[model samples]
Target chain A: MYVDVILNQPASRDYRVYIDQLETLHFDTKVLIVTNTTVASLHLETLQKKIEAKELYSVILPDGEQYKNMQSLNLILNACFEHRLDRKSLLIAFGGGVIGDMTGFAASIYQRGIDFIQIPTTLLSQVDASVGGKTGINNSYGKNLIGSFWQPRAVYCESVFLKTLPKREFSAGVAEMIKMAVTFDKAFFEWLETHDLEDEAHLKEAIAKSIAIKARVVALDETEQGIRAVLNYGHTFAHVIENQTHYTTFLHGEAVAIGMVMANILAQKLTFLNADEALRIVTLLEHYDLPTHYRIENVEAFYDAFFLDKKSEHAVIKFILAQGIGGYEISRNIPKEVVLEALKEANA
Target chain B: MYVDVILNQPASRDYRVYIDQLETLHFDTKVLIVTNTTVASLHLETLQKKIEAKELYSVILPDGEQYKNMQSLNLILNACFEHRLDRKSLLIAFGGGVIGDMTGFAASIYQRGIDFIQIPTTLLSQVDASVGGKTGINNSYGKNLIGSFWQPRAVYCESVFLKTLPKREFSAGVAEMIKMAVTFDKAFFEWLETHDLEDEAHLKEAIAKSIAIKARVVALDETEQGIRAVLNYGHTFAHVIENQTHYTTFLHGEAVAIGMVMANILAQKLTFLNADEALRIVTLLEHYDLPTHYRIENVEAFYDAFFLDKKSEHAVIKFILAQGIGGYEISRNIPKEVVLEALKEANA
Candidate 1:
């Protein structure tokens, strides 16, 4: 199954996202595969055998979110230079979100942009990160603080690679999948409550459904000027949580899982979501063993961090809140006291 | 006078290039003016007084082509983060091509891209670099080896800034203007041969004419897929010249002047340009005291450096040669021995 991401603004920027499809990929130009040491150890040979290029090279970075910094970005670029990969060269992001984000960014700025494709190994990246064109790296200030809206030529997601994923990482992927359902698709939310993603067929369906919803949102706002901001349903809070934890404690999706719960408390306070609906979202996250709470060490510091998020314009923090199931509201005028109260509650 | 660059493919990318028109400008968001030590000392206050913003800051880098690297790019990004400049905040490229390229590149990646305006201080920048959306920095591999095609919100070119420009630098800017005329506008080339740009009125006309030609060619091919390559007529040889001399022996425009002479020699060999026409170009470059010749130490090493250029694809070097005044040709299949002979002749 595949979903076509149609960006009408620049018709040429449109591409397709294929699910469970990994076949012989042929390229007439030099190709560079950017992966992490972890993914390289497990699946590099598997991916290498499937690609045919005039020249092939691999840049294996250290695994983990902490490694997604300017250093890793440079590593990918240096490899491109070392191999003399020109404007027509191709880069394959052959790992999870970290590898994909850094690789896409490297491609975006390498010779003022080049072609790249995504072969997402983890479930989190396959369903969410790999689909959107938001490519960037983390810095001392925040996550994805520096990047470009560079879309990939194509994306290939195969379940076979997930067989080697750790259980915690697999659960982290489910968090992003649930984020999609709770914010945009109530039917999918209910389906997740009943279906066991442990089953291969159900997992594939969820991936396709989540990607379809994401594709629709990205198509509407390629630059996140409007409807696309809603895709950050849990990410606003998640960024602070990830920062406080130094990106080592939680997987990106795990932070989002906790963040969603925190956002629900704020949504309830804003009267956008009810108690029962909020509880339902929390219960579904628990079903996948995803973290649903984070203790905020300092509420004031956390609140101040929100202002630094790229979403905040001037001093206004635009919060993407769930307006019950399958709907959302972007509130830029949320009072500080109201947000502080929710943060206090989440701290428990 | 102003030339509106209409990029119909993505209407939002369209902007205007204003010549001799730096008036009071206003912005509601935080603004950062990126310049260099020399520009800041000469005209920073002049530019700062003409802009009003909610908050204003400046990042002054060292002035030189050697400083146009990743380190300078990082300094700009660091400042944006330090100032907590959000997505809506604006950046102003307030110096020559080095500052403009680094600033535009910094803005392109800061928060996944932001709006930037060019206020070029140098003649080389005002007439050429500042008008185009090409933003990047140089690396060990080559010049502008990393960057993005990020257009500025607008461009403001003021002749007042040129009051401080050294005579040699002014001649360098004329090299680019001559290049524009030789490739796209024969009438403009003939007029330039007769007009003395030392006169203010003549200089303004030439700036507007060069920008108009550039804006038209850019509108046709924004990404350099076709006719846009013609703009790099002298760059194929210039990049190697700069690289060979470690970017210290000559200014970029000065190198381009010499490169144009070298390209003309090759063009004459290919019969794309007559000997008389080639001599006319060399005379015009010399008219402004621009360097019209360079000693080639090793033809083989210089020839090998062309492959490192981003313009070359898959070991094929695409040479942008002058067909005659006002016409150009992109030749990819020129037997290299013919090029070697031209290099040997230009060696004199």
Candidate 2:
């Protein structure tokens, strides 16, 4: 399946993502494949043999979310400079979320922006990160505090790469799909509930559906000023969870799994979602062996941390609640008592 | 003297640059003014008195081009985070080029990009830097190696701020105007030759003409992939000079002054510019008390430095040369001997 991610950004018309084999993306411009050490060791030679470019170079970065920093970003950039990849050159992000984010960011900044493709090897990036054009590095203060909404020229998703993907990370990727389905497509959510994603055909359809939903939302609101916030579904809580755990404790999608349960509890408290409907979402997450609960260390501390959230404003927190399936309601200033109640329900 | 800079970038629509007094923009969005210590100490209170925003906050950064880095950029981001600035929040670049660049970069990355306004306080920024959407911070590798092309919401170019600008800095700004005139508008170049920029009215006109020309080119090519390369008339040589001198020996425009002269020499050697026309541009630069020559320490080393330039590719330096005024030509692979001859001519 070829998914066309059409972003009306300057000079970027549109690009297609081939959700199968990595086709020959023939380019006259110089090409640099920015991948992690693990991906490079596993798949670099194969990619080099397949991709036809004037010059193909590989920049191997250290594997893991922790290595996604300014220091690691420079490694990719220095390679571009060394390779003399001009403004017209292309950068191929050939790993997971961390690699895609860093490579996209490097392309956005290099010579004040260039073209880059997303060859998302991990399921998390293919379904979410690689499609949205949200690219940046995490600072000491938070995750993705500094990034740009730079879309990729194309994205190639080959499930073969997921064969070696860690069990925890693969499960984490499913959480994001469940996120999209629950918030935007009731039929898709139902399909996921009945379907075994472990089956190759089921997994590919889920990935394609998730990307299409994401592509539509981003097209409508690329900057996330309005309806796009709906796509965040559980991201507000996920950011907090990621922060509280120092980002080392959970893969982003893993945090999202727990975040969805917390959001569902909040939805029930706000009377936006019935208890039974919310429970269905929780059961789906657990079926995949994903965590569906997290205990707040301190209620007051957890509540106070909301202000520090990237979405919070002037002491008012903006919440994205699922309005049953295939719908979302954005509420500003959900009463402190309601939030506290939701936190109580969230307590493991 | 109200000049409108219309850009056709993704979400960046048309923005006005008030060369007159700072108007009350009356933004309902939260406004965070990003300025330097010097500019803030001089005019923060005055700006506070003039501008009316819903919630006005200021982030005062350290002063100097040397401080324009990711660390300084973080200072702005940290302030945004501390203030809990949301998606609609606007950042004001409230100083010269350094402030505008870093502030614009911060806004571009904050929440994956937000809106920013440029309030250029220095003559250099008013004429050149403020109009373009080019924003970034300097890194260990080089100046502006890490940045994004994020345009501002608007620009307020009040010459009143330049009253406090130092003499050397003021002259440097004149060099940028001379740069614009020499490359794109011959009529403006002729007007500049006869007029005295020291006189306030003439200076204002020169500034306006420079901005209009810049705005026109930028509108056509927000990304410098084609005719926009002509705008880099002297920038290639200037970067090499700035690098060799450790960026401390000369102001940006001062180096540009010398760079333009070097480019003219190369153009004359290629017979692209008549001797008299090239000399006229050189003479006009000198009239503004800008440098007309530089001594090459080592021609081979200076030529080698060209490859490191962001504009260079495949070891073939793309030289933007003067093609009599109002016209310029981009030549790739200009013979090394022709470059060597130009360097020897540059050596005083």
Best candidate (score: TM-score): 1
DockQ (CA atoms), all models: 0.74, 0.60
Candidate 2: misplaced stretches above 4 Å? Answer: A24-29, A37-42, A52-55, A81-84, A241-251, A269-271, A296-301, A345-348, B10-12, B23-31, B37-41, B52-63, B243-249, B297-301, B345-348
Interface RMSD for each predicted structure:
1.5, 2.2
Q: Which docking category, incorrect, acceptable, medium or high, applies to candidate 2?
A: medium
Cα lDDT of model 1 overall? 0.91
Error of 2 at A47 (Å): 3.5
- Residue-level lDDT of model 1, residues B90-155, one tens digit each, is 999999998999999999999999999998988889888987689999887777899999999899
Worst 10 residues of 1 chain A by lDDT: A307-316
Chain A superposition TM-score per model: 0.96, 0.96
Off by over 4 Å in 1: A296-305, A308-311, A344-348, B297-302, B308-311
